[model samples]
Target: MKPGLMMALSALMATSPAFAYEIGDSISPEVAEKLNLQPGKAAVVDFFASWCASCAKEIPEIHQFIEDDKSEKVQVLGVGVDEDLAEGKAWQKQLNITFPVYDDTDQQVVESFAPIGMPALYYIIDNKVVGKRIGAVNHIDKQIRADLKELGVEQ
Candidate 1:
């Protein structure tokens, strides 16, 4: 973000009703149910928008990870942050994204995971977010494998 935008966002967050989300908080139940989110398992929850270029690049990599892993112990869930549902859906179709997406048209889930930039991946295990990676994905597969291995998750 530009300095100006960063300052503006900072101001907004400072004035927001609650503090920004931190690691280890529970993923909301509504979101979990909507996406069939896998808790009590190794999971990567990617928050994205259809308009985000980073997300566009990163999502397919995650799908490929799912395909390459071929394990039930790990999961990747996409959370759409775009306000326009149709556009978000279209982007998903355009990319032929295979993983399930939970739409955050109201920004509730996204806001809860605040300080979020585009294409953010929240790494979770046993339902708690343990780590995060934010940017275009290049080594997602390797990272996931390493994280799961470190977490002692069978994947």
Candidate 2:
């Protein structure tokens, strides 16, 4: 390949978005109803699979954050993408998390908000998604803090 072409390709790769998903997409209506969320507060919606290794690895950290951030400004929802509700429930119970878990077996919310991968984290404020992360990247806490700050969610 030509040097200029190679250089252009490298630049493009560098400038591309880090994650595979974005914000501002509609969540499942059923999910919204189940959570009983209004448009004023910030919420973190986690799209995950019960059998996903990365999802299992990161859930505890996320649950910790939810427990620590319980000031009514932010909350976390575990939207399981399992095909079986019973399996999802088993995983949820095994994790011992306190946050609410909503079943997304049909991929309605996953397809709309996170079509790219498992373990998607979406930060929503005022019924609008502000930031999102796809996959189980390191520094999960740092990323959440940054997104919270961007959404003006104070501790």
Candidate 3:
């Protein structure tokens, strides 16, 4: 390959995750611990950032879902991938997110998931990824509800 092409490829590779978690992929033990995922419980891991407009829009809906959820069969967790911890915390407070959120200032958590888009939702059970939704989604709460049902996590 040409030198310019090689440099471009190197840059892309440096920015991208070595591997993205997929359905049925088991999350590493360290990451599982960081998220505090329980063995039997189902969880919806949402990855977001302070600068993502789509995340700003979807977080409130997710919070609504969390409020409306009474079954407790599934837990919705947020991973704020902002480099600035203070900014990420401010965003969470602004959104009034009540569900548990992990501040990923070092980016280890988000790097482990390696979602393809700004706002990524991963459905996990027993430390394994069961489903995923990438990018900005319409009616994300509803979509999550349906996805949970499909995953046998009754609302």
Top lDDT model:
3
Ranking by lDDT: 3, 1, 2
Q: What does the lDDT read for residue 145 in candidate 3?
A: 91
Q: How many backbone clashes does candidate 3 have?
A: 0
Candidate 3, 43-151: lDDT as tens digits: 9999998899999999889977887889867878989999988888998899888888999898888887878798999999988999999999998989999999999
Winner on lDDT between 2 and 3 is 3
lDDT by residue for model 1 (1-155), tens: 79999999999978674744467776667645665766566778888887788778776677778888877887888888889999988988999988778888988777777844777888776656778877766777777777777768766
lDDT tens digits, residues 71-122, model 2?
Answer: 6777778788898989988998898867777787766556556447778888
Question: Per-residue lDDT for 94 in model 3?
Answer: 92
How far residue 87's Cα lies from its native spot in candidate 1, in Å, is 0.8
Model 1, TM vs. native: 0.80
> Where in model 3 is the C-alpha error above 4 Å?
1-17
Worst 10 residues of 2 by lDDT: 17-26
Please give the lDDT score at residue 97 for candidate 2: 62
Residue 124 displacement in candidate 2 (angstroms): 1.2
Whole-model lDDT values for every prediction: 0.76, 0.74, 0.89
Best by TM-score: 3
